[model samples]
Target: MTEVGILGTGAYVPDRVVSNDEVGAAAAVDDAWVVRKTAIRERRWAAPEQATSDLAAAAGRAALESAGITADQLSVIVVATSTPDRPQPPTAAYVQHLLGASGAAAFDVNAVCSGEVFALASVEGILARSGGHALVIGADLYSRILNPADRRTVVLFGDGAGAMVLGSGRGARVRHISAHTFGELSGLIEVPAGGSRMPCDPAALEAGRQYFTMDGRAVRAFVEDQLPGLVKQFLHEAGVVPDDVRHFVPHQANGVMLDTVFEQLALSRAAMHLSLTRYGNTGAASIPITLDEAARAGAFRRGDLILLAGFGGGMSAGFALVEW
Candidate 1:
């Protein structure tokens, strides 16, 4: 069997930097309150003309360059995003066109913030059988769906995209990947009016049901009650112990919640990778963006164990183990 691994990684954030003060003012809070709550001072917002595909393409170009491959060499392109440019035509299709990856099979996966890991797991199987390179991208434009006056969701997200080029041979070899969804808790995080069930009609728009909404306390509790055990069980199933992991790249949901869960996991030797402080939560892009930053900074060594964990809307979670 050919070994599939991440050949290269890349990420891109918009140029417009939004400060806590700016976001807080709209949310009826202040900089201190925002910082004390999210540990985030600022985040990036996409330009008026920029869409999710634009950011994904930029990141994809960088990953291709880093991997020493051209866009035409890609056999698959999977974009994980909850915010598609439109309701029809998958976001990955636009990304594929932008990158000129004419031959690749392109699609989108929406597991909300856990989309990236889900896309990775999906692509791994495709590449394993097809024997070709693939590009997996996580991108979101949360700023568009956020309720500006709602502190709960508005101040916790930014616009960005992260990408990884996967192929058979050398790189960070993927060990195992797992995903779970708690459908009963799906309403914990949602945009209540956009889909078929609710349709974004005039009434829905007037009702403010189009905005992204989340039950913060419930989400925090879910993470606290479930993440650590999931991580432990995932590791055990993969035949690895917590001590064997050297790096943990998790969804940049909330700094405080992450701190609480980190201690519970007891990965004493592992260094938790974070980009939320500077990027807020980039939705599905969070984990890959953090991973790309760490990789560029020369953070991993050969034989090092890296864990990628993602959890969010759908009340879902995804985990992956990689050997560097």
Candidate 2:
């Protein structure tokens, strides 16, 4: 079997920096409260003209440059996003057009924040069989869907995109990938009115059902109950122990919740990579964005084990182990 690996990684957050004070003012919470809860001081927001595809394309270009590959070399372009540019066409189609990757198959995957890892898992098989490079991107424009006054959500999301180029070459060699979804808990996080279940009619708009919402308490409980055990099981299945892992790149969901899960996982030798302090939870973009930041910072050593984990709406969790 051909070995698939990350050829390059890249990320793009919007130029506009939104401070805690700005979001807090709308959510009726002070900076201190926001910081105490999420450890996020600021996050980026897309300009009115920018959409998810714009960010994804910018990041994709960067990743292709980093890989020393041209867009024409790509055989697949997969965008993992919850907030698509529109309902009809896939966001990846827009990204492919923007990048001039006309030869590649384009599509979108919506595993919510877990979409990146799920997309990675999907592309790995395609590229392994097809024998060409693939661009996997995770992007979101949460600022557009957020209810400004909903502190539980609006304060926790930002706009950004991250990408990775995969091929049979140097870089992080993917070792194992796995994903799970608990559909019974789907209501824990959701945007209630945009889909067929509840059309965005006048009444839905008036009810504020179009805005993103979450039961923060239940989500926290779900993560606390499931993530650690899942991580342990995944490592065991991957034939590695916690002590052997050197870096832990997880969804930049909540700093405090992550701290708790980090402790429970007992990966004592691994350093947790976090970008949420500056970017907040960037939906599906979190893991890849954080991974790109850490990689560019020279955080990994040759032959190091890096674990990537993402968990979010769809009540899903995805994990990937990479040998760096």
Candidate 3:
């Protein structure tokens, strides 16, 4: 059997930097509070003209370059994002056009913060059958949907994209990937309007339903109830002990919830690769962005075991165990 794995990874954050103080004032909290609660000090925001596809294209291009492959070689393009270029014409189409990967199958996946992990899992499955390279990207432009005045969601999100090119070869094989979704809890975090249930219009805007709203308290409780135990189970099923893991890469959600997960798993802050403090939460793009940063810094060694887990808005969570 041909082993499927990432050939190269790349990430992009807009040049525009947003400090904690900027977002903190809107959320009615000081910079210290933002840092204390979420450990996010700064994040990048896309320029007014930049959209989700622009960031995705840039990251995808870099990934292709790193993989030493051209866009035409790509057999598939799986873009994971909650914020697409538009409600119609999936964001992957735009990215595919930008990359000139005309021959590849293109589509978008929306698992919110867990988008990349789920997309990667899908890419692996696709490659298993197709036997070719695939570009998996997680990109989002949260600033557009977030209520500028709503401190809860605005302060925690930013604009960015991350991508990885997967192919058949000798590389870090993703040993195990498991995912589960709780549809009943989907309402825990969401954009209340714009979907079929509540179409976007003047009434929705006036009611403030158009912006992204999150019950921070509820989300924290939900993650606390789900994530740590899921990680432990995934590790157990993969037949790997916690100590054997070289790195635990999880969604850069927040500090408070992360603290709980760390305690439950008995791991130190250093063991869990985190970029939340600097990049805030880039939604679905968080995991891959952090992975690209770590991989670029020469973080992994041969035969090392790495764990990747992500959880968020479909009220979903998943983990992928990799052998480097």
lDDT for each residue of candidate 1 in 1-324, tens digit (9 for 90 to 100): 677999999999999999999987878998888888888889999999999999999999989998999999999999999999998799999999999999999999999999999999999988888779999999999999999999998889999999999999889999999999999999999999988899999999999999999999999999999998999899999999999999999999988788888999999999999999999999999998999999999999999999999999998999999998
Clashing residue pairs, candidate 3? none
**By lDDT, is 2 or 3 better?**
2
Minimal lDDT window, size 10, model 2: 124-133
**lDDT at 318, model 1:** 99
lDDT of 2 by residue, 59-173 (tens): 9998999899999999999999999999969999999999999999999999999999999999998877877899999999999999998898888999999999999967789
Query: CA shift at 7, candidate 1, in angstroms?
Result: 0.1
Taken over the whole model, the C-alpha lDDT of each candidate is: 0.94, 0.95, 0.88
TM-score of 1: 0.99
The reply for model 3, stretches above 4 Å from the true place, is: 267-270
Residue 74 alpha-carbon offset, candidate 3, angstroms = 0.1
For candidate 3, lDDT tens digit of each residue in 43-89?
99999999999999999998999888999999999999999999989
Q: What's the TM for model 2?
A: 0.99
